[model samples]
Every structure is written in structure tokens, then in C-alpha cells.
Target chain A: MATKRAQKMEETRAKLIRAAREAFASKGYAAASMDELTAEAGLTRGALYHNFGGKQGLMQAVVDQIDQEMVERMLVAQARAASRWEGLLEEGVAYIEMALEPEVQRIMLLDGPAVLGDPSQWPNQNACLLRTTQTIQALIDEGTVKPVDAEAAARLINGAALNAALWIAAADEPHAVLPKAVEAFRQLATGLLQTEG
Target chain B: MATKRAQKMEETRAKLIRAAREAFASKGYAAASMDELTAEAGLTRGALYHNFGGKQGLMQAVVDQIDQEMVERMLVAQARAASRWEGLLEEGVAYIEMALEPEVQRIMLLDGPAVLGDPSQWPNQNACLLRTTQTIQALIDEGTVKPVDAEAAARLINGAALNAALWIAAADEPHAVLPKAVEAFRQLATGLLQTEG
Candidate 1:
């Protein structure tokens, strides 16, 4: 199904995405120049335009790539946990920890939301939300979580986790602040557990 | 202590801050022009730099002003509620409601964070968090809430409310989405109540 020309196009797109990631990681979206990005990819301006509409397009492509990587990393962390509930907690905590990484912080959490608007509105950005939602739904089905809306819980938890991450990343002593974030997250999450039900 | 010159300088500062707020609220931080902003304030470029440093500084001032307004609005909402718990809930929900306003959405949430970085890091932005933290601390002292770390709880709640507001603001049907966000927020906050503890 793949012709040589199509294959070449695919390779070019991938190269541009890689280059854009480095640019975003270093100079951020605003400062990352178009000429610099194109040159970094070992491609011409025409190739850049043909693949992505322009700077914003390439920036979004870079974001999607980073988002996918973040999700994969989260899934890996989730998989390592021993129980579903623990796994879910691990996932939330992991989300906060991931925010500590410079690339994820600079690209996904900061520049991505700033440039692209709310991440929830993005089609591809839903992977993390959907995953969190499904986990909550499964917990509810098992009567572990209370009889609350799964999607609602997911949104609240995800929102809290994200904010905690932002707080920790910007904290003067991140190592000192992290445990506090996790403990508070666990306590808030407890509100929806099956105790009342 | 009450010199006319000092009073005039203060007025000039307030006027410039007001003008900057309108510029940022209308055009966002990046697109707002320095020349346009100073002219709108009926002042000169020298005044802007002399008072606020530059565009970034002026924008931070705008954000600080908006942050103060938002916190004052929250305090007023809290005062209106029947109980401390009710007041706290009102304050949280009101925060979500505030996100619906375009000015708050544009300047306080989106551009404010995008330009000034994490609002939590700002000197004056802590009023909201401090207010929430104090409320949580009072509730915990009285056993209205669990034994969770007060500051942690505040950060998590603030984060959730912020994210929920952003979600609702960008939703296709904000009215419909508002209920979902509030209901979800209620459930998450309830998880930390004394009953659960």
C-alpha cells in the first residue's frame, strides 16, 4: 500500500517532527524560529510547508508526538502496579512526576496548552483522559469506587493531578513538595471511594 | 506622608494597570502592542517602563489585578454562604463560574499562565491559594474535613477548580457542561470530608 513517494513523505514528516521536538524543547514555541527548525531537520522550507502548514503546524505535530510518548510512559507505570486501585493511584502520581521532566513540562504542560488551548479539546489529547476514565469506570463497576459518574471523577482527578504537577514543578524544592502533592491527591480521591455506598 | 505628588503617582500607576488589563483582556498578552497600551493609558512609553518594567511586567500587573478581583469575588461569595463549609463550596463553585467570563478565561487562566508561567509562582496570585488553604485548615481544625495536609488539599482543590473551569469555558455547551463540572467537583471534594476520614 505504500509507494516510494508516500514512504519518502512519511520519512520527511517524521524527521520534521523530531526536529520540531528539539526546537520546542530548547527555545520553546515562541522563540523556536522557522528557519532553524527546517534546517535542523536537514530539510528545506518547501518540505516543512508540504508536511506541516507552518510553524504552528509543526509545533502541534511535536506536541502530539510528546503526548503519545507521555501516555506510553504512563501506561508503563500503570502496568507496573500490583492492583487496579493502586495502579490508578500510581498513574495519577506518575502524571505528576512526569510533569517534572523538562521536555514534558516545557512542551506538553506549558507550551502545548498555551499554544493549542485546552488539551481536553484536542482529539489525540484524550488518550490520557480516556484511560483515566476507563479506570474509574472499571472501579465503579467493581463497586470499589462510589456511585459517582466515572467521567466526572476522571475529570476532577486529572485536573487535580495536573495542577499538583504544575505546583511541584514550579516549587522551590520539588523533592520536598512531591510527597505533599501525592498525599493530598490520595485524600481527595478517597472522597469517591465506595465507603458511603 | 500624604503628598500630592505621591498620590498622583499612585493614580498614574492605577491608570496604566487598568489600560494594560483592557489591552491584555482584548488582544491577549503576545499580540498586545506596547505603543498601543501606553497610549490607551494616556501615558507615555517612559511611564510604562518606569512603573512596570516592560510589556511582560505590565502584563503581570494586569494578571495581579485580575487575580485580586477574582479572590475578592470569591471572598464575597464565601461571605454570603450559610456555613463555613457551604461558604467554601460556594467559593469553589464560584471559581468554576468565573472561568466562564471571557476576561477571566483569557487573561487570568490562559494568557496569564502562558506568559507569566504557573500562576502559583506569582507573588500576588497566592491570595486565592492562601484563602483556600486557610479555609481547608479551619475545616480540618474543626474536624469538618479529614486529617489531610491542609496546603496539599488546597493545591489539589485549586488545581481541580482551575482545570474544571478551563474545561467548561471551552466546552461546546458550557451550561450543560457546568453541571457536570460542578457535580464532579462536589464528589471529589466530598472524598476528603470527615465522614470519609
Candidate 2:
């Protein structure tokens, strides 16, 4: 039936994404072999072409999947913080820290931007942007953050964090670079805070 | 004479770069025809390969040329400011403003990043980064900026401006988006300033 076919197709898509993610993480996008990935997924090339359109398309899907996971992880980090303002800061810092992970450093930070264009412009990021904007708006309402344009502040905050990660990943010594990046990110973000009377 | 030949070669290189810049600015990197660009320069594809590797190499040269010009313009903006800290702010704002220019938006901001990878990793950016880092160190010494890692602060500030420009360029209403981005940028930068006792 139609329901069974839909479930089967979903399984096929998930399998392809998982295989492609592993290949991309290990070998990188440029060297990642499509034929090998398809075989690893136990699917044919036709299935890959039909589901994801081709290699670049598969890369996009993998990037999206990874990005979604990153966002979820960030949310968890934010939740653990004691205050909303602290949570926002933690979220930004978490993004910078994730750059230390090899899979994240390679796939999301390096290969993703080179292949898929700007992550900010990606459809998946709009969700993250909206969420950040609302959080910033709330901070502004409570006099915790300066009354700058919420969306604008969100964009700059997000941009700063994203670029810091890129800087860390590309650096010769990522571990040494991580603390500097995280500290700078926190300092830069404090500009949004309302000055205490 | 060898001197005359060397001069002629430099002229050929300049002509080729000029033609390619025009082509890239007008039609973008991918759309611009290499044959037409060489013809426009009164050279051959062979000359292009000789001086630069090919289209990509030529693009690098063009990007370098533009990036150098942009840095010079930013310095001029900085020099016009009342103080060094003000100059730094002016330089960042000037960078954002330049995104409004069509050639910058098309060739440098869009096509250049897509083709050449992250601008931060570009060899030419090191010069700019060093200069910015030195300026930041000066600010820290003067107690104008807080005691943070100057290089890290410099990277975050530069990244914020660059990403802001990218955001503005990609927006449907760039003109309307400009003020918001500029304000957010100014607000975000204030975080690094030493808090008044």
C-alpha cells in the first residue's frame, strides 16, 4: 500500500544520508565516493539519484542532518544554564566548542560552506535564526539585553559564533584556538547586554 | 632588452586582470567566458595560462586585486576618523557599506567566497588581520578595550562585519536591511569596550 511504500522510501533516504555522512566525515566531500556510499547503504545508484538527486544534493542532506543535530545540542547546552542571559551566552559558546569535533570541523564548518554556499542562506538555518531572534527579543523585553533590532542582533551574534568556529577549525592548532575563540565570543556578545544602573 | 620585455609582460598581466575583473563583475565568475575575456584583453588563452593558471587562477588574482583595493579604502576611512578606536569602528562600517556596491556584492562577496573558500583563510587576509590585531592591542594597552585576546577579538569583530555584509547582500531589500545591520554591528562591537567604573 501507499503507507508501506512511504515508510520504505523514508528508510532508504535515512540510510543514504547516514552512509553519505560517514563518507563525507572521513574522506571529505571532494574525495567522498558516491558509488562506495551507495554500496555502503546497500542501495543502488539509481536510488541515490532518485532520493537526493546526486552527490551535491546528498551532501546538502547530510549537512542539514548534522546542522539539525548541532542545533539540538546547543539547545541542551542553553537549557543547562542557570539564567536566560547565561543560556544565550552558553548557546553561542557551545557553537564555538563544537568546532573542536573532527566531524563538525570537517563536514559542517569546512566542506559544507565550500560546497553548499553560505549556511546562513540555507533554508534550515532560518529556523535557528527565528528561534535566536525570539530569544533576543525576550531578553530586550526584560531589560537584560540592549534594545537593538532583535533580528539584527541575532544575525550578528550568530555570524560571530559561526565565523569563530570556522576560524578554529581552519587554525593549525584547534585546541589552543578554542579558548580564545570562546572567550572572544562571550566578550563580543556582552555588547548586547543592558548596562546595569 | 630584458627590462623592456619585463615591462611588456607586466602590462599584459594588468590588461588581463582588468578584462577579467570587468567580466567577473558584470557577468559573475561562472557565467563569464574565458575566451571572451582573453579576447577582450587582446590576449590568448595561452597567455592567460602562462601568466595565471587558468580561469580559477585568474579569479584569484582578480580577488586579490579587489581585496587589496578594499583594504586601502578601509584604511582611508580609518584615517579620517577622530581616534584610533573610532577609526576601527569606521573601518568596519566602511566594509559593510562597500557591500552595497554591485561589483563588490557580485564578485568579491558572492562569487569569490563560493569559489575560493573562506575569506579568513585567504593569504591576503592575514595582512588585514595583523593590522586589525595591532590596532586592537593598542586599544587594550590604552584601556579602551577590555583585557581579552586581541587576535580573538579582532577575528570576532571582522567576522561580524563580514557576515553582516553577506546578510545584507543576500536580502531582498538590502537598502532597508542596511541600517539594521549597521546598528546591530555598532551595538555588538560595544561589548569589547572597557566598562566605565
* Candidate whose DockQ is highest: 1
Which pairs of residues collide in candidate 1? Answer: A191-B191
Off by more than 4 A, model 1: A1-4, A43-46, B1-11, B42-46, B195-197
For model 2, the docking class works out as: medium
Residue B85 error, candidate 1, Å: 3.0
TM-score of the second chain, each candidate in turn, equals 0.92, 0.89
Which candidate tops lDDT? 1
TM-score of each: 0.90, 0.88
What is the C-alpha lDDT profile of model 1 across B55-112, one tens digit per residue?
8888888888888888999999999999888888889999999989988888887777
- Candidate 1 interface RMSD to the true structure: 1.3
Q: Candidate 2 on B98-169: residue-level lDDT in tens?
A: 877778767776677556766677868745666778889999999999999998888888778877887887
Give me the candidate number with maximum TM-score. 1
Can you write out model 2's per-residue Cα lDDT over A97-121, one digit (the tens) per residue?
8866778767876676556666677
